[model samples]
Target: MKKLLFFIFLLLLFSCKKEIKETLDNNYYKKARICRDSKHSDSAFYYYNLAKNEYLKINDSLGVGNSLVNMALIQTDKGDFYGGIESSFEANKFLRRENDSIFRNRLATNYNNIGLAFHFLKDFEKSSFFYIKTLQYIDLTENKLLCYNNIGDVLISQQKYGLAKIYLEKAYLTQNSTTLSKVINNLAKAKYLDNKNYDPLPEFNRALKIREIQKDSIGLNSSYETLSTYYLDKDKNLSLLFAEKMLTEAIKNNSPDDRITALQRIITLDAKNYLNNFQHFNFINDSLQTARNKAKNQFAIVRYDVDQKNAKNQILIEKNFQQDIGIILLALALAITILWYIKRKKRLEQEKEIEVKNTQLKISKKVHDVVANGIYQVMTKIENQQHFNKDEALDELEFVYEKSRDISYEKTDTQGEEKDFSERISETVSSFKNDEVNTYLAGNDSGIWKHLSSKNKEEVYQIIRELLVNMKKHSKATIVSFRFERENDLIRIFYTDNGIGISGDVIYKNGLSSTVSRIETINGEIIFDTKIEKGLKITISFPAS
Candidate 1:
């Protein structure tokens, strides 16, 4: 079903491609988009500014706005979020009032870019606000669905699982393309996180299959990360496996943030092998720092250039308007503006050359940081670090070499000293006792720890963890209680919370779904009593063994 929808989406996306070129001569705008689609981002950036300069020469506000948007897209993709937002803001001045569908679409895209930048910056509320603004300007059904999915993503970040599902579901049903795979995946997550009984695996697999079919390297990287996050707590080997996949894709795209996340996951999960990966990690860290610093300075320079251009253009416009009151002055003013544009064209060519050279120089520095330092560290380790076994050192050097050519692991220390079952339970409950949720634990120290197997204790811990996650995400509960019961052969637990309970049927969100799955495997039975306004209560019984 999703494949069919995605096929439809491909047609629509391509239709836009055609229309995009049809409206322009074999012009810079068309060329820029073609280059962008083909992943020639540097060329795309250059062409977009060529388009912008052409528009400026004729005072074509709409053309200039579109060029700015295209440039903003390039900047955003390059991780220069602040520069992208600045371009978007400048584009907005020309885009805001135009009712043309194309203009409005640009407006929507600009807002979405702003929202994504803020999201990456961890300002989620502001991000959500911009996404809402995007919705207001969006006109097409396909674009609207994209916004819905994006808004759903924001809601998920806020832990509004139920509400996020509503938006995601709407997008899923209306989507004409497989791009809503993310929406489907997010919907599954909402179900699990809402602590309802749901199987999110099918949707996850479905999304993965779609990305693979599409050959979407970036989206595939995201799929790997998503799968890795889901498995991190459940299966270390599997988590590391997916994180490794993420690392491969991240390297292909030269995405440092993804590299860090993938490497951190691998390191935490594969501590036994950290010594093997140390030199490679140092190389990645140093290279990332260097690349980011260069990008920061480059964006700063671009912003300065843009500000100067806009200020000068405004001055010219004001002069032209004022001098138009006199015929002779107006003629001179027009000639002056024409001459200025001629000079600007030559200046723009020089600036473009400088920009390309600057980027190349930065690349050289990044290479030095990665290769030279990494090789030095590896040599020093082999010669001076005698504690590392010879075979292990050779293996580690090979690992670093592979990484130098391409791309990502981690183990987390326990948050504190490990405690037995009872103490762990107490700490878990108290952990959730923040200002919002007043929580109490009863019968926790009542010999429950003495008779249970470690497996049973772990299962119980996971169940409680899932319960707490549910409460925090969905219940909006202020007061919560946990009661434990023990008998000759059976263990019983009761959990209740005061919050907005299930609105309708309980289709089990993500965390609760897994909890249910685990309990079923243990031959445990659980029941929930929920009312719309009152709250929720759960009762569970499982074997002591």
Candidate 2:
């Protein structure tokens, strides 16, 4: 009977422990939801941390990942981009391990959220890369509308308006009741950027209708704000009406960004009728500033709370380790310190090397400015001297010009000045073209030549002059064309001669070696494609400034 009583006691103890755990978990979740709804981010973060710890203790991977994502959202809202990125990455790692399709979709959403955080931080390339990755996974999932809209937003931020419009349109097409308003609003924004002013009204009206039907104050505010701006030129009365509505909703939503945007719009519109709207504009502007200051302070507090919680957790983890283990850790730490010192020294040396390169560039700029300019002036004086022998003076001038050209090339030889180099080449080529060659310069006017360092200008002139000389000597063709354009930050100079084109095999033994050497000196690349009947097409890419 005593043994039976002991078993009953053990059972009760285990059951009570489970009940207590469940109660804590449920209470933490409830508090987190309430805090988030109330915009009490610090309280939400605290509850989230409590829930996350419990989930981690129970080895609940999905629960832990979910809590981490929520914490990341709070971190993002608080403008802690680095912390948010770390949290999102951690969430993604856990979610990836879970094989469920629903969890995989959640992982994609997390990636998109991380991209948004990076976007806010002005890390556009990383934002675009991650958003694209999210889209790839989102395409295979049921949450297509959300994925499309987010991808569109990322593309828009990247200033790829054409691509943004495509994705936004797709989102609009696939959107359901939950996503319709947002998709429509995004579509309207994309359309406005695309310069489709005539059709934006329909899209904005559609989004506004959906927002009104759903009674979404934030969505309604955004739509109203956009409409006010759209109609400001067309209908002042309607614009004022919409602007007032936006201001009211923005205040109700307690969104400082929205309030600022609405006020700024009203101020701009009121400038036409300054006497009537001046008071309203001033009042809104003051309120907007106050709201912004309060939001900034609240964000700071949230960040501090998050940091404190993380510090406490870290301290707990450290305390759980054994004393002997700590001694071993100290030894390991010393070894790591030595290695880190060596790595840091090497890193510093590399940075010094980069500094040296930059110094060289600055020296080059000075040489071009002073030495090259002085040489050119001397050359001009020689050319103008009537008593100077014509052939001898020309020879002296050429020599001086060549030296000036060499100095300019040395100074501006860096990759950043290649586009300027290409434009100078094009101008030189155009100058050399006479009635005989019927030379036509085609391609976009880069205007990059205007900024070329003296050194780059000289090299470009010599290169183009060499090409023209070659064309005149070897090519028996009637027409020659040179085009200058930039593609992917590389300046492309295309030289085509209608004259008799030589085979690449034949050119291997000719002036090709000198040409190749000259291009390689400035880190420029060249491609030559020629047919027996067709003209030789020589394409060269130089680093453009």
Candidate 3:
């Protein structure tokens, strides 16, 4: 009873310790969020790093991912674009690819921030690629429109005006008032860039008016800069006025990049004060670059320290991982062995079923040729003869009956080689001819049958007999012809009949299906030209060797 009480106490103690650690981690995360909300980015990033480290101690991957994403966004805002991209990539390593909406939102935010950083760095290709990645995970309609606009902006930077317009126009149609001015500005820019004669002043002014009414200072800076650029070639004095206005708004917004851009425009348009504007440009540009460099280095150092701590933790993880891996590998090997055994057994059963099916098909073909075609041949002969011989017809019918009884046994016909094959074919066709039908055969020579194997000859003999049977039964033709030629390594045969033609869609029936199967067994091709107006024409060809 004492031992049981001790064990229970220990379990409760461990659970309490875990809960306390999680509470501490949550406190750090809360502090980070508070700092970020108050615009204390540096303090927020520091707290987030602490939160991330605490989450790592408890193996809280989602917490780690969230902290890293916030860190990346701060770095991007501070102009450390390379550092931001690195941090975002590292966050993806910790984020689990679950279908949870929160996870997807975080994933999209990470990729979109990466795209914004790359855009600022002027890596338009990478910017566009990451923007597209954002689109895949972002579910919100507003966020998706923003991604499309980002892609359009990248396209515009690359001078792909037509493609930029495609995305901008799509975003414009669905944009709310918050996004309307931005979309319209980009659309107008694409139009003006694509066609030199396109007057973009009205659209640009409309966008500017919307921004002014919304009191969007950052947007106002953009509008003023665009107006300055538009009039630079057409009206220098008006362009200089817009440049001065842009500089004033950029200063009010504390946008260093915009201020530098406006300064360059003023130096060109206001030549009298060129030196003054140039000096101001150099100072702000140099200071901004210096500040950006310092932030980049600081973020890099933070990431490097985190990596070092992770490396130390990984050493402990590796020892336990190796032990687990041995057990896993043993289980995997047993599973693979069982799977392979099952697959092999299934394969053997499938092979046996296929062998049975092939044998049945062979026997069925024998029945059709020996019994069906034989009976038809005897009937044709009797019907064509002027003086019917009862004894001869009875002998032929008796021969067919004997073949049918022994059909189950696969007996090879060796008698085919003993007789002249050409004469046999000629005799078969001649027996089919009657007062109503005239049949002709050409190239029925012994030399043509010399190179053919006994199997090939039998298949060919069966195929010819099947065709003649079909013609006698269905084709009410007055004339039929069969032409044969041996060219180099191939034999070609053409069969034609002047009767009511078959339809364009050739359906093999009345033993014609079996005839096709026979020809294919010897690697032969047969084409039926039912398109002919009068009767059917078939061309059969096969390799000789």
Candidate 4:
């Protein structure tokens, strides 16, 4: 009983595995067929992905590559040129490793699909190259009729009507009835384009005969339409007859596109007729335009479908990228939060240290100014009493005592003791100037003093003082001029020096750097224009309001 149960279990397990593999293979082939029929190219891509994944799991490299090539065909049909190229290249890579004739022919089909895509893109050079390559692996006799027709179509689009006729003629000679009819129609058009007016009529007639024989209503409608166009200049009666025939066939076939073309031809021929046909012409023209618009809308829908599929793919990619970015951003935020907390803690500690240092500085300044000066003064007086040549020393001691007393008095008297900013600036400039460095000041207005806040006034004074000091020390200037002009809501300060001008390459250091920063502290634009042999001119403009 145990042995029988074991045998039954093994049979069931093997059957299940075979069924699963067969199911996967059948699904893959069915999906490929569906994709080819419906032109749902993105869906085709997804299915191709699934098919290739399953094939790879079974270690079928050739199957995987063939699946990729099939996906490339769908991409090419949907106008994804770059994608088609990439897919074709990937398929070729795998195909190179396989020495099978069938696989090589599959690679040729991929090349042909790529060529067709490029032809639609109007890249004739690349299209020709790949089309020629299609013949390398596949027998020309087997698929040459289709290949020749495509070559002729491309050539006709390129306006190579003469060469197009030869290829079309070759395609027309083929045994395939459908290819022969298409080739005949193309050959007729190529002949018309080539200015061989007599040659097109026979070709058009032959294509029409084939369509009639085959009972292809669509092809008959197309042939009649083209025949009507060819006879328009040569024979108006014949043209009108064919045009009416085309309209009848288009209506019978229930093809809006063909009906639209037929209506257009009828309308054109009606215009060239007598005034009695005017109303008919207008009616047909209106109907044709309306139909054309409808067709355009349909084309737009096709484009929209393609775009929607692409947008969905893009959304998938963007969603994945965003998830990754979100994770990275979360990590970055946590790291930054940690860094900020550490910095904040360090800053608080530094602030506490600064408070302690400030307290010590206040005590040290008091001791240096008051106690040290008082002790020196007392020592000088005692030396004078001893007649130790202390007269000159006593004068110096008295000056130090007076300075210390003023410091103490200033520290205590906090009422109306703030120095006038303009006066302070003037004194600093005066101290900086001498015979070697001449300083010129212009447009000093006392009203300008009242307009400034204490902080702004101090900043302005420091900026000016620092600039003058830099000019005296580094500029090597003989004459320095400062001009202040207040106009409207703007204040302009101009500083010019007849110095060996600084080059553009010169780097700012020390006081000059401080001056630049101070000017920037206020909302001002500083422009420095200098020349090698000329002078340096600095203009600062401040918005007064």
Candidate 5:
């Protein structure tokens, strides 16, 4: 008797649990539907997710699929195209093939939403495929028309006009006014695109008439754009008129994309008012980008908050497991701290050794570039000049000594340039010129150096000195040319010589490698041209910002 009583009690408990689960899932789903109908997308998404979890608890595949479909629709509408496609694919896993009309309809909707997401993302091929897939499960005429039109639109984007026209004609059989206008517009566009001689003006006007009569502001914007594009080459006045109308309609409908399209058209056709239209285009484009970024960020935050909330709820349900996890995590944290401390101690020792080695390397490079190169330049001057000035040679030696002293103090070489950087650069380049080598410079105006940073100027000075040093030592050049020009925001320096050029497999020695590093430090680029049969050519470019 006691066993029978205990069995009955267990059955009652299970029955109550099942009833409560079903009620919760049903209530959550209904609330989600209400939120969705009210256009509260974030709230609807949250409730749908909750209902989906409840449905999973009760093993109700249909309920789970329905909730996921709703969530995906919201995501797509909110411009989360990738997230929408992902959710639709997850829902497809639960929605199986069935004889029931409702089940097939749900499956069709899921595929259609995925197609729509792909269409927005501009994956025309995948979009066409999914739209075709949607047609296989779709039964309703209106839905079938939508899928057909979508496939046609995708084909048109892919420039397959003939195939696009066939599906568009099929969709045109629909009596729905909105769908009819959409299909007619696309079909006419496809025709006009396929044959330049084809006059789609009649059909375009017909669609425009319907949209205007129905007071469809969005549809009217599309019509204006189409008409403007059609008359762009034929009649500039008419194109500008239509483009202005489109801009007005777009502003009324609060559509940034249409506004941008209209602005572009206006700017192209109305060259007199180019600046005004271009400014408006820039503002609208920036605002649209910012808004889309904000919406995507909000969607991410909503998903994260929901997941965290669900996790906390689960943790609350398993308090004993939470205590065990906390203890294990604490132990892991302590062990990590001890290991990190030991690693940090070893890292510090290694870093000190590396610092000393780096300092030694820097000193050696400075000695080679400054002191050695300075002495070499003096020797070249004395050897090449018929009447070498002793005072000028002494001044050059003093400059080298000052540089060597500053290298020991780790001071920058860019300071004390109030005398003018351009003059210094010219003096350095001319100092290398003699009877044997004719070094010519062009476009070395002080204006070119105005926008360069001090550090960049210093690096450029060093790079030029290094190149001259390399030429004196390696290349037996007779003629050398240095061209300096400012191309918009970039400063370009061109160096060419008439000597034995480097082979394609030439390796960069210490001097060349240091030049490369200096260019990189200034966010500049260098190219060595070894294809020249005679002399080497190197071009350096950097931003003037």
Candidate 6:
């Protein structure tokens, strides 16, 4: 009796849980449908995601597929073509093989959404491929007409006008529904683009009348633009009138491209005070362009992040089906570890910031000493003598420029500058050379740098220049030597100077600190050795890659 009661209790518990799950899933799905019907795309997407999550909990692949397809429609509507493509592919993957009517409908929707995404991306061949795929699952004449129209549009884009006309005509004959106006418009476009005698104005006007009766402001904007474009060459006055209609409808429908085109037509036809009128349209055009560019960039970034996350999740879920105990524990442990790591990291970051500041201060000092003094002397000479010396003035300015460039470690060998890298390096080295301290540079030629990657050469040049600057500031050497030699796959730089030998407490000054940082970044090795009687000896080695 006890065993039987326990069994009954377990069955009741399981059934109750299943009932609650089903109730919640249906609630979210119903809410999503209501939002979708109301054209609240964002709200619909949010509720659909809730439904998808609920379905995922129940392992209902069909429900999840439906939610994904629905979300993809919103994505495509928002012009996130790549994002829609990804979601549509997921829907197709899960729903394509299901033979039930609902699942088949979902698969058709996925195919259609994929086609729209590719169409927006201007990949007509790929768009046609997916549009054709929907045919096997979609039995609705209206939906089939949409597919035919899309295929025909792709053919028109490819300049296969004759073939396009056939499919478009089929679309026009498929259904006489309220949406058939768009199919007629497609047929007209095909005939007109093909340079045929099929006067598209009649069909375009017919579409305009249908949309007007339907009270679709969005649909009317397209119709108005079409009429304006079709009449632009035939009747200038009629074109201007239609253009005005297009502008009014575009403003009402929030159609930015149509607004821009309408503004251009008005600007052309209405020359008086056109610029004043254009100021408002220009602002609208700029806003639309900025929004589009921002959306595209955000879509790309979000797609990349979501793809990375989903790839990891898919792999983990495929390999493991157990309860998420490990993940939970990992998260808890990570939270604790992050607390201490962040504190330690903050201290280290502060130290690095201080070091960089000190380096910048050192550079400023060098700039003040070498640059300011040179300029002041030039000004003093001119002021005392009361004479203009263009050559001498130019020489002082060049000296100041060279020193400033060295201080900043900037590369002036831009492509348009027509400057040579070897020449730049030689100049850098010669800039430090003086009567008291001579700097010699060897193997800084094309042969040495030709095989090295641009990045590798840049870092190396920077490191060597920093070392030269430090030597000039502190080494007080009579001679400085720099040699670049390649051994096997390694590029070696051997630097020596006959200066006061390295002391025990050699400061990590700005120049030396930056050079060391560069070496570490490249995973290179550096050696420093000094003797009481010998000058500084430093050698660094890295790959030429």
Best-matching candidate per lDDT = 5
Candidate 5 segments whose C-alpha is farther than 4 A from its true place: 1-25, 305-545
Candidate 2 clash pair list: 408-455, 409-455, 417-545, 418-543, 418-544, 419-543, 419-544, 477-499
**All models: lDDT?**
0.72, 0.67, 0.78, 0.66, 0.79, 0.72
In the range 1-545, model 2's lDDT, one tens digit per residue, is 00111211222233233333333445676788689778787788778766766665555656666667777767665556677787788777556553564465556656766777777777878977876776655534335565677667667667888888888777776536536676777777877877854477787888889888888776787688778877788898789889878878877877656666676677676667665556755776687556545655654565465444553343234344564676799899999999999999999999877976986878777667766776777668776886767786666656665566565555444444435544655565666567676777777464645454566556566677777767777777678887778655567788887777878787755446657777777678888887546778898888865
Please say which candidate is ahead in lDDT: 1 or 2.
Answer: 1
Clashes of 5: 0
* Candidate 6 whole-model C-alpha lDDT, 0 to 1: 0.72
Model 6 misplacement above 4 A? 1-40, 292-545
Clashing pairs for predicted structure model 4, backbone only: none
Weakest ten-residue segment in model 2 by summed lDDT: 1-10
| Every model's TM-score | 0.52, 0.46, 0.53, 0.41, 0.52, 0.52
What global local distance difference test value does model 4 have? 0.66
lDDT (Cα, tens digit) per residue for candidate 6, span 337-375: 999899999998998779667776787788899889988
Please give the lDDT score at residue 186 for candidate 1.
Answer: 74
Query: In model 4, which regions exceed 4 Å deviation?
Result: 1-29, 34-42, 56-59, 78-86, 97-99, 195-197, 217-225, 235-545
Angstrom error of the Cα, residue 508, model 4: value is 55
- Candidate 5 structure quality by residue, lDDT tens digits, 7-74: 11222233233333433458788888789778787888888887877776555777777888878877
lDDT measured at residue 544 in model 2 versus the true structure, 0 to 100: 65
Q: For residue 489, what is the lDDT in candidate 4?
A: 66
The collision pairs in model 5 are none
The residue-by-residue lDDT of candidate 1 on 1-545, one tens digit each, is 11112222332353355444424533887898789789887677777777776777666666777777777766766667788788889888766555666676667777888887777677778878998887887766776787787778878888988888888887886644455667767777778778746667788888888888878676677678878988887888899999999889888877777787788888888888897556567788888778656665665665455544754364246466554655677688999999999999999989877966776676567557765777788788878976868787677665566444332100001222245667878887899999888999888874865667766676677788778878897789999999998887788889999888774366374347778887887789988776535888888898887
